[model samples]
Target chain A: MPHDHHDHDHPHSLLPSDPALRVKALETLLVRKGLVDPAALDAIIDTYETRIGPQNGARVVARAWADASFRARLLGDATAVISEMGYYGRQGEHIVAVENTDSTHNIVVCTLCSCYPWPLLGIPPAWYKSDAYRARVVREPRQVLAEFGLVLPEGQTVRVWDSTAEIRYLVLPQRPAGTDDLTEEALAALVTRDSMIGTGLARAPE
Target chain B: MKEPVFLEPWHAQVFALTVHLSDTGVVSWPDWAATLGAVLAEHGLDRQLDGGEDYFLAWVAALERLLAARGLAGAADLDDLKSAWTEAYLHTPHGQPVRLAGG
Candidate 1:
């Protein structure tokens, strides 16, 4: 099939609303019917959220900005280093955190099923999951990043990391200057949610 | 012989809660799915399936466990939540999720 530029109907959302009642109904049938148990359900949830969240990621970014040795560890092996923080490899096994430099830029996305670094970063925001972000980023990362108010120098090629289950990603934003006296909490606050996602960067001190 | 339905009603409700929370900026993407999954497993719903519905069931079960663990609902609460969920989540009209029993 030739690639038609006119393809508008993305055949992804087959069900406009895949409601929760459907799961409840199934649980009533399966669990009540003895097909599944309470434990398996627990395993799935425990493995994901609190075990790995943005707070975890924020901790890492903060450490990187403050502690050079730990930053070296994180850059060397994101998954193992993050697990050292007691959260890693739960949702997506592999992990990577690309450092942003003044001369270069980087962005992240998941063309597939939103493969994100959950253990490091918290849940992804709604806009990140929007088709607008997914479809445009891979094709036009620099342009999209610009829309987020991030403009890389012309010589810089915006490196876009398409997140996969085998390898998740986080952005080690270049620590803003003039905040040498600022505490980690303040720096973490400067690290906007989108910055970790690689669409934006941390702002300078106010 | 019919195939096992991939998802259940409660599971659907769980997803709606998680998505709606994320939609309203209450949760993020990575944490949304994982947290939902973790909550469910903590509630002890993992040792059930043979891992057939890993992707779907994980979060669905998480939703159920969240509501129950948080004690966020009773039967009546669940009903009201279902109503709100149907409207806010599924985009269904209010008071018309189903017709009156015998209007």
Candidate 2:
């Protein structure tokens, strides 16, 4: 039989190889006051993954690009306006849509946890919750964005919004160059899911 | 022993879907899970049991523990988050679930 030794990538599963051995291990860890029960942390992850996702936010971005009046309305009444789509079910009472201009770009991160605009974008992508991405992006926005294939010129402030509260933000990137003939629906298709999350830009058809 | 890992289609789909979302730009969800999964592995821990879907359950268990300890959010927030999740990814034939008062 293969050895049941635990290691990185597949560690000691919650259940031990042997019931008796498992009890002994628990005695050393839980019984002997060793490791903490990671219940709260788990709940936090489920809360975001289950409640909010990036797709919700993407819908809003698509709508804004399609209508001028809606764009104006989005900036002025983001929460109220999005509610009309019936995406207003949960913690979406407060939605702040950040526009991306030629000089400015916006991305979001939750330093403590992966707090996201669940109502807008749905659950955030897995990488958003990583320590490396969250800790680094806010401080070294350009470097992190570059990792995501987003290269900005020197001196551009990569505005990183920490969506740690009710006010979740969705980045509305500037329309890409070329392909002006694309219809609104086509443009909506051009809006890459990443653009709404601010990691990438929306590209117009060539 | 844990229940089967990847038992249901939706369960497995959720995991893969999460990865796709991360690839797109919703970075945190997968990153955090990977980080946590790495830590558990390093510490000689199994993120889930042998049974299919245990891994997903483990993820849920870990996230719950994290949030409850923080105390910043509560059942309502979790519910809202869940509702948002269902709408964004679950794709139920019926309309979205009724939003709870707090949600």
Candidate 3:
């Protein structure tokens, strides 16, 4: 007990170290000040939490897997084709769809910052914004993918796409084998969020 | 291991606040992205951000800067209100909702 400041609680030390409290306080302040509409804030949060998410990307992927012509259009102009399906907005402008072929595997990383296609993918996962993933994925994609339990074949090439604010990417994963009989809705179920992110493959038929 | 998109409630709240601000034409998305980008670059140089508390803290900081620039709120105002909320919560008993005066 040499020099413990908390031994005697000072008045100034009453401030909680929790940032969550601070954020709530800030929100209250903003609302009181008439700066932001509380309803609007709730609406935005609800949209991200409920309406928008990787499910949209999964549908896009499933469609591409089920329809060859749609796949070609998606590959040609992802932004235009994706918007046609009513999935378009901020953070997803100028999207480029990169298909995962037998010889080449494409992965996305925002080395500088987390520049993701929010409309299609919704909020990016925590790992996507981590410094380690951002720094290492481009340099050693095979190693990174291995950590994600995705081991590519010896002949397959690993292509890392570093996303930017102006341009974003969506990886179209290869469809699992023996899923030809699967319906588009069922195909959508097999498409996991990571499949579109290129860190993991689509779920196998079960 | 699969992780949640937002680690904390405040993370989503702050993010939503920024989006709401953008939607209302209070600030443009480009400006918000640029501010957050600058903040990330500034704070990310030393610490290894895991997109958890530290990441959202930076987001709050960037939001503060944007709000200050737009004259919506200033640093002093945020600090004062934070202190007031701290006082309110400290006096509040356990399992009770903390409220500001007349709030």
Best by lDDT: 3
Q: Could you report the Cα RMSD, in angstroms, for every candidate shown?
A: 14.6, 14.5, 4.4
Overall local distance difference test of candidate 3: 0.84
Docking class of 2: incorrect
Clashing pairs in 3: none
Alpha carbon lDDT of each predicted model: 0.60, 0.55, 0.84
Candidates 1 and 3 compared: the better one by DockQ is: 3
Give Cα distance to truth, residue A146, candidate 2, Å. 0.6
> What is candidate 3's lDDT per residue for A1-206, written digit by digit as tens?
34556635543334445676667766877788776888888887888888788889999999999999999999999999999988887787789999999999999988766889888999988788888898889889999999999999999999999888788999999999999999999999988888999999999999
Compared with the true structure, what per-residue lDDT tens digits does model 3 show for residues B42-85? 88889888866777888888888888898888778787778778
What TM-score does structure 3 among the candidates reach? 0.87
Candidate 1: deviation at residue A44, Å? Answer: 6.7
CAPRI classification of candidate 1 = incorrect
10 residues in a row with least lDDT, candidate 1 chain A: A10-19
Decide which is better by DockQ, 2 or 3: 3
| Model 2 segments more than 4 A misplaced | A1-56, B1-103
If the candidates were sorted by their TM-score against the true structure, best first, what order would they fall in?
3, 1, 2
TM-score of 1: 0.59
lDDT of 2 at B26: 33
Best of the candidates, DockQ: 3
lDDT (C-alpha) at residue A47 in model 2: 48
